[model samples]
Target: MHAHGGTRSGDAVPGDEELLARLRAAPVLAGPLPEFDPAAAPDSPGPLFAAWLTDALEAGVPEPQTMTLSTADADGEPSARVLILRGIDSADCAFVFASDARARKGRDLAANARAALTWYWPAHGRQIRMAGPVTALGEDAVRRDFLGRSEAARAAAFTGTVSEPLTGTQEYDRAFRAARALVAAEPDRVPDTHTVYRLRAREAEFFQGRADPFHTRVRYVREGRAWTRTLLWP
Candidate 1:
């Protein structure tokens, strides 16, 4: 079928059957991997995550701070988008991200208090998955987070509306210019809708892709203040 705007005669693309066959033929986890030992792993995956993050940075992986943030609506429909990881908190129990309160993600969080985040570094053949309950940070922290952002980022947050279709580029340009002027005139002005969210992970898993069919997965689950580690079959 043609696209909504109508397809051009020469604008051909692969059909669904061709794409399905290609997907079936492609190799999975065809990359080098490091060794993993559940026994040697720490009780909590937090510190190990920090080390892995450092390794990713050292390996020159672009956008190491970027992650796939996944959240489900009240009815259990899932949606995902890429966003920067704000920080790993002091206790290592949670990771944080910032958003506009009126954004779709914010609404998802409001309806469902749980979410998941995943980080993958193809060069290192590593992946981390985390899931747990989410909570909003205090006003003070939200203000600080918003202020610490770049001028453009701060101004965009000031726009407050996220995921809604814009009338046009010109409309956004006008909003951006106004925000920039307001910031220049009143440097401390912060929007009340700027928000930060913390996801306290109840489960964290680290996957090391192996050259062989059998990969290594080490999962950590929180129990009270402590954590339990287990090795899963690849």
Candidate 2:
């Protein structure tokens, strides 16, 4: 019923009924939330997404560019991970992110080129979801992005063998130390496995939550080179 010193209030686990009650009692959309007028939204999802992202940044949402990247393996086993957005491609209007080509998610994309990205900024009561096929960028783009990263990031990227079971921290330390030294010696070095991917969304949805229970949802469906917008029932 009470939390001890040095323990967070959330650390106190409750019984099943109490847990459900606590969840129900928790406040949602208790915000000076931004207004979203679906009628005035942009013709394409890209402009609308850019506007929402800008709103999130201006509202001081932490890690506003962070998103959940979802992929499925060859057998349809789903996998999701949080990653920072690497800028969107303006020419093709695809969302960009990078990872080790040998990583589980990378292999998943290789086998099943389709994936989804979801962005949620609870502070603004907003969620955006995009799903479609993914494609790997050219080596030049991959190398440029890799070289632009911080030294520590480059060093970590150099430590390869992602998703493999580590024998111990000692092994990691050794590999990381070597990787760091390599990065120091060759600042422009990029791991062969470093890859950049773009996800071209076929369908995108924007959801805005309202405490009054009348939520707003707008979906954009790509048709040929144009996009069609639809207002959906909440």
Candidate 3:
């Protein structure tokens, strides 16, 4: 039979079969709910995140620490970009590498401390969402991290041009050379553009995709300076 939106000439569409196959393969939810006991989940979201992160690593998911960071300006202009998850702590939620004074995201964070992070592991069909206030690291911390980086990586940071429009390769090289010269003259000087921001999570949600119809979602919220965990229907 001819597909929908068929041409008058009765020629089959190019992508119709592929689209139909994908639709047919979509998961169907028509069974009893999976056994997910909230009491069995980790009392704290941080530990639960750690456990799931380990699973992602063991499963060989690529770039397990890759996450999307969402931020907004004081004027309410929303911005989002992918950033590497550097660290996590019980006191704070997660750390991401960024220059406080360099990019739009950094400017937004300075204006508004609130931020959100989303980590998705498609291979394992799992996702984690985190929201919290951001705090910038001191100069000492930035220097320590900078020193740990390889010379090549450090050189990249010295290239002062960040988030600026670029025209050609020659211009990029020229900028890189200027940045390197600045670094060479004063190695101890911390570039104003190099800074790290840590997210102190006030709320987080973990999602586990299942072959069955009922997926699992657990949420943790901070209340009165304490975190409370609850389960939500997916």
Candidate 3 collision pairs: 29-213
Q: Write the per-residue lDDT of candidate 1 for residues 161-215, one digit (tens) a residue.
A: 7888889889998889998888888778788777799999999999888787667
lDDT tens per residue, model 3, 43-76: 6788878877898798778999789999999999
Answer with 1 or 3, whichever has the higher TM-score.
1
Better of 2 and 3 by TM-score: 2
Worst 10 residues of 3 by lDDT: 27-36
- lDDT-based ranking, best first? 2, 1, 3
Residue 134, model 1, lDDT: 94
lDDT of 2: 0.89
Q: Which regions of candidate 1 deviate over 4 angstroms?
A: 1-12, 16-28
Error of 1 at 180 (Å): 1.3
Q: Which 10 consecutive residues of model 2 have the lowest summed lDDT?
A: 1-10
TM-score of each: 0.88, 0.92, 0.80
Is candidate 1 or 2 superior in TM-score?
Answer: 2
Best by TM-score: 2
Across 1-234, the per-residue lDDT of candidate 2 in tens digits comes to: 344546555565668999899889999888777788999988899988888888889989999979999999999999999988997853345899999989999999999999999999999999999999998999899988999999999999878499988999999899999999999999988888888999999999999998787889999999989999999998
